[model samples]
Target: MRTIRIPYAELPANARAAVEAHTGPALKADSASEGLNSEIAVRLVSRTGEYYVKGRRASHRWAWTQRREAEVNPFIRGIAPALIARVESAGWDLLIFEAVDGHHADYRPGSPDLPKVVDVIRRLGQLPCPTIELRHAEQRLERYVDRPEDVAYFAGDTLLHTDWNNTNVLVAGDRALVVDWGWATKGAPWLDAAFWVIWLIASGHEPASAEQWAAQVPAWQGATVEGIDAFAVANAHMWDEIGGHDPDSWTARMVDAARRWRDHRKA
Candidate 1:
């Protein structure tokens, strides 16, 4: 479910003060059209310039997500919007970012943007996994693996975004900037390419065509068929639980796409 957005004025006085202390008084505050996990998704116009502000009460589950984004932003520099500042006050946690002058990435077949997306994925896979503690993909995929031993297949030290929905990527100039690092994981190098397959399928590619695109990435080429199969099965099951069999929901459709990919590989 989407978090309910709140107006900048509606935030507690201390929270607003914390922000103004950094950006000078806000000249304008407009609700942002993007972002689903933040309660405060607004673009604030300060004397300095434009900034995207995101926040939620510290007690909310997504509050942890805010912290993760803040922790990982600096490390993901070239692929993410610059982290301008971070603040906490009035029991709310927040992240302020340099707003990107780009739109969500286009993943449709034949779009010129597709090559940039692949390049970003390839570049991200090359960075050694940061030393900070990250949720291991094996642990995250545990419940869905058909065989208990298959969980080990996801283990690796590569840094992975894990979620590849087009909304999390922005196409800017000649590059695709990856945004929203909350679900970042340290896992198999092939994991990011695997996640992108479902997104390509959702964007109108057949399962085989999506895999063909994924194969262009070196990491995907290195992945064992058995390991990739397990990842697909786990992801399909995970979304099934999230969407609860709702056929019309995007999550449910992704669940089907993941299954189709798994079946295609089996064939």
Candidate 2:
């Protein structure tokens, strides 16, 4: 793959200076896009620890998103990776985080740590963020909801980890930590729960087991099981929009789960 390099001159002076100070010989780096931001990773050696310095070439919109997470992350420490430092250089924003120590959840499924994965989602829901309104999964669904038939059905909100794929979750020891907060938005908590259900099933759990686990997620004081089911359906539909590559059997299973949840909601 071709890689682009960020010149030191293009970064903020403080950030450039910090990178130079830490990375003795000005190590080679690569630029890649992770979701919406231009991301760059450079190797750096420092007295604090060996680290991969990462920055997102800031766009007007994503800059605020990055800054919001940087602001909110410090308060939600145990739930996220530790923030090492922030670097502002030449119109660019860089976030240096304590490198998490584990592979993405995709690599370690059969290790009996699945429940902890569910636990992290539930715990994040329980956190009280009065200022941060959760992004509704319904809004995300509406982006792909092309028909009036779909519109009336997806008219609610929940806290959603817009990207709940296995790749974004990291498993360490007995715990599962969710990373890549760029997509974290408030909506129906069930939207996140439902998406995770699909993820768990795609990762090889039975549909019944996935649904059972999802159903057991404790209500976060203001959410409901019915709301979760709606979120699940919307989540599945959104996944289909994004061209999810799950096998037909997996998609069928998700459809079945959505139907069952919908029927239960109606009853």
* Winning candidate number (TM-score): 1
- Model 1: lDDT of residue 187: 89
* lDDT of candidates 1 onward, in order: 0.86, 0.57
| Candidate 2 lDDT over residue span 1-267, tens digit each | 112556434566666676655444444433323322334654444555555456666664555656655666654566677767776766667766666667666523464666776788788777765356444445656665445355344344433455676656778877787766766676554556666666666566665667676666664334455455455555556555444554366455555544454444446
Clashing pairs in 1: none
TM-score, one value per model: 0.95, 0.68
Deviation in Å, model 2, residue 222 alpha carbon = 8.0
Could you tell me which 10 consecutive residues in candidate 1 have the lowest summed lDDT?
244-253
lDDT (Cα, tens digit) per residue for candidate 1, span 1-267 = 778888888999999889878877999989877767678888899888888888889999767778888888878888789988889999999888987788788889898888998999999998877777688999999999889999888998899998888988999899999988888998889889999999999888999899888988899987898898888888878877777745657666787787787778778
| Best lDDT among the predictions, by candidate number | 1
Off by over 4 Å in 2: 1-15, 20-38, 42-44, 60-64, 106-109, 144-160, 220-229, 244-267
Task: Kindly report which residue stretches of model 1 are placed more than 4 angstroms away from their true locations once superposed.
Answer: none
